[model samples]
Target: MKLLLKNTRTLTENGEFEACDVLIVENMVQTISSFIEIEDVDRIIDCQERLLVPGFIDVHIHLREPGGEHKETIKTGTKAAARGGFTTVCAMPNTNPVPDKLETVQQLLERIKNDALVRVLPYAAITKGLKGEELTNIDQLSKLDIFGFTDDGVGIQAADAMYRAMQLAAQNGKAIVAHCEDNSIVYGGVVHDGAVSKRLDLPGIPSLSESVQIARDVLLAEATGCHYHVCHVSTKESVRVIRDAKKAGIKVTAEVTPHHLLLSEDAIEQDDANFKMNPPLRSKEDQDALLEGLLEGTIDFIATDHAPHSSDEKAQGMLHAPFGIVGLETAFPLLYTYLVKQNKITLKQLVDWLTIKPASIFGLPYGKLAANVVADLTLIDVEREMNIDKHTFYSKGKNTPFHNWNVTGVPVLTICDGEIVYEEDFHV
Candidate 1:
């Protein structure tokens, strides 16, 4: 099929343009020129004044399928990813039946191939059943075309286990993504263990719960010679740790969720469990540090950590509720509206964080609009303004704290592997 997208601002690695025509043939970009004279084009998307970008990629998302289909399945989660302008997403294997075995990873691949709206790359669990005890079959699992390995909902508390896992993963040429939480220090607490938790008389989850583990992993990774990635870094101390690790020349990378970068524990005072998440949002100082890290390029990319739990699960009070918020559907609009428009970050930097940076970190063949690259693209109607509406969400979960928040940009069309997976104006 031949697709022509014209009158759009194409976002290149260098910068943005006023207008260009993106020509696609099948699953590759045939040409991106000022004008194209082509015959027998199957479709033409008039992206006048809109921003055409390489479809965003999320390296951290929990599909919760092959287990918690009630919360989110491959179909629902990937639809959410597509609607959020993501052409590719990596699913962390902390599912009911952990995807540590090669057979489990293969099953997930099949499920995603049949059900997902966008590409879903599975991340096998670093340990079988994610028990953090025995290591998963890295040799076999790595051969299945998976991306990275992570016992993601929890840090492999055993240093020996983690070191061994990283060594094996490094030898296999795979990266080790760590949850970076010291569950031992977390002590089963709920919110950030500070003013908000004290005032509400709730159990507190301390900042060190994350930072301590990040510190430990950095050292271990240095010794193991593996590419270590810190997931959803939320504290100032964690930022310093990652920064120092990078300085020390460790093969390290880290990501910050939009919630942690934009929101703080102050929002928790409003009594909404939706604000709740694992490594719960921290203090204003922590938020500032996270933003500083992003501005200075210390943080590698922005991942939604797009954890989706059902309303029923989230409805369970703050203390007993599941820890996460639905982010994939709202990430772009929120970031573009807040960070880009405010000039805290440039559009090019923002796109790179969402696209190229992530691809680089995970070593995927995505995040570029150049010729012969996979034709995964996201067309954004930058001029469009809208409010966050859970009703329009494609995922089964609607536990986002940003409900009703005003957002200016939205994805108008999403194309994956040359297929028009999602389009706002579907009928036309």
Candidate 2:
């Protein structure tokens, strides 16, 4: 079968746009040119000069399946990823009945195989049941097609445990992704330990809670020669430590979430639960450092940290609500509107952070648009504008703070392995 995507445009070397047509045969991109006329094409999509690029990849997302189906499932979550321009997403291992055992891992694999709309690479939990007490059988679990080992919802509280996990993961050639937070330092904080917390009369999660852990793990990573990745870095100090580690030649990479990049504690404005998140929105200074880190290559890439929760849970106000927000449906458009259009960064830089940068760091053979490559692609209509509506999202969780925000650079169509996975307002 032949599929033709015509009148679309590709981003040029100079960050300009160039018109092109992409032809796919089976699951591989056959050719990309200014124009191609072919007979017996099974399908032709008029991209209408929309931007065509390698599908975006988010290495940090919570699919919340195998147990947390009330929040999100594989089918709904992957559809949300596709709609947000992500053709590939890495699922965090923080579900109920976490993927520490091989049997449980197999259950998730089967779910992905049967229900995923796009590519879903899952990670094995680092500790048994994510209790942070006993380490999982990393040697045995690494033999599977898992991306790495992580107990993402909560940080491993014990230094000895993390060091040992890193050693085991390094021996097996797996990355050790971490959620860096010190529960001791956090002290039941809900918002950031900043003016927002002080004025609101609520407990605050200090930067030390996030940064101290990063400092510790980077050292462990260096000693073990492991690829240590920091998830949802939200502090200037966290960026400083990661920056220092990279300078010292430690095998380290870090990701900054769109929420952290776009909003700070100052943006909270009120005691709202939707604005609540782990590694909570920090001071504007910390937010600035995060952008600088991304620009200077200190921060490896962009991830949404797309945690979804029920509306009822989120309605419990700032202190009682779960710490997360739905991100898959609004990430690209939000970033583009806030960062790219504002001229804080170029559009090419944004695309790279979302695609090639993360893929390169993770050693995934994706995030490129080239001949004879798998046809994992997204067509984005940059000129189109729409207000983000939570009710319209494919994700079950409508817990985003960016509701009703106007934005562009939205993904209109997504293809995975030469098959149409998601197309806006159309049946795939």
Candidate 3:
């Protein structure tokens, strides 16, 4: 089938919007020109001047499947990713019967093939059962076209174990994606160690809990020559350590979540569990450093860390509730509103971080837009502001703090491999 996107406004190499039409034949882009005849098209959509770009890519997201289906699944999670303009999301391995061995990874690949609406690159576990004690067969699982290795929900607590994992991953030519947290330093803390935790009468999780682990791992990566990618970096100290590592020429890269960039501890009002997440929102100083790090190229890109939890579980309040909130459905709009509209980052910069930079980091081939490229594209309504209604979300987890917040740059249509994965009736 042929699809023609008409009257599209797309960014050019000069970072200016140019009016054009893109012709997609089956799963590939056939042409992108100022004017294209549309007689042979099976479907046509008038973009009406909305911005068109390569579909977004998220490097870190939790799609609870194989065990935690009550919270989320591959089907619901990928559908939510499509709604948010994401075409590819790397699924973290924190599931029941974790992807620690060949059979588990094979089973996950089969499930993704049957249920996923968007592309999901599954990460194999770094430690078997994610116990942070024994290493999984990294050499064996890496051959299954796995995304990488990670124990996302919990950090690898043992330095010797991490060192061995990094050596094996490096030998297999794969990245060791880390969830940087020292459980010993966490000290049963639920929120950032700052004024907010004190005001809420909650235990504080210190910045060192994240940074100290990162400092150790970067050095390990230096010795092992492994691609060390940090996930959901939330503290100023972590930023400084990463910046120094990058300057020292260590093979280190890092991602910041949308919430860490958009909200600080001050944004937390009361003991709402929706505000609770791992490596909890830090002080305004930490938040400002995160933005600066991104602008200065110290941070590589943004990821959702799109963790979802059941409502009953979240209602347990800040201390007892699970650590996480849904992000895939709200990442782009929220970032566009608070960061781009506020003149902190340009729209083009935001799009690059969400698209090409992430794909480049992970060596994925789907984040470019051109003739002959895969038809993984998305259209966004940059002018029309809409309130986020959790009821309208395709995700089972509506645990976002941005609900009811008015924002622009909402995704209107998303296409993956020439198929319409998500579309709205009309742009408002």
TM-score of each: 0.98, 0.98, 0.99
The sequence of per-residue lDDT tens digits that candidate 2 reaches over residues 227-258 is: 99999999999999999999999999999999
> TM-score of predicted model 3?
0.99
CA RMSD of all predictions: 1.4, 1.4, 0.9
Clashes of each: 0, 0, 0
Per-residue lDDT tens digits of candidate 1, residues 269-336?
Answer: 65568988988988999999999998887899999999889888888888789899989999999998
**Candidate 3 residue lDDT tens string, 1-428:** 99999989988777789999999999999999999996878999989988999999998998999899999999999999999999999999999999999999999999999999999999999999999988999889989978999999899999999999999999998999999999998989999999988898899999999999999999999999999999988888899999999999999999999999999999998999999999899999999999999999999999999999999999999989999989998999999999999999988899999999999888888888899999999999898789999888888998988889999888999999889999998634
Q: How good is model 2 by TM-score?
A: 0.98
At residue 110, what lDDT does model 1 achieve? 90
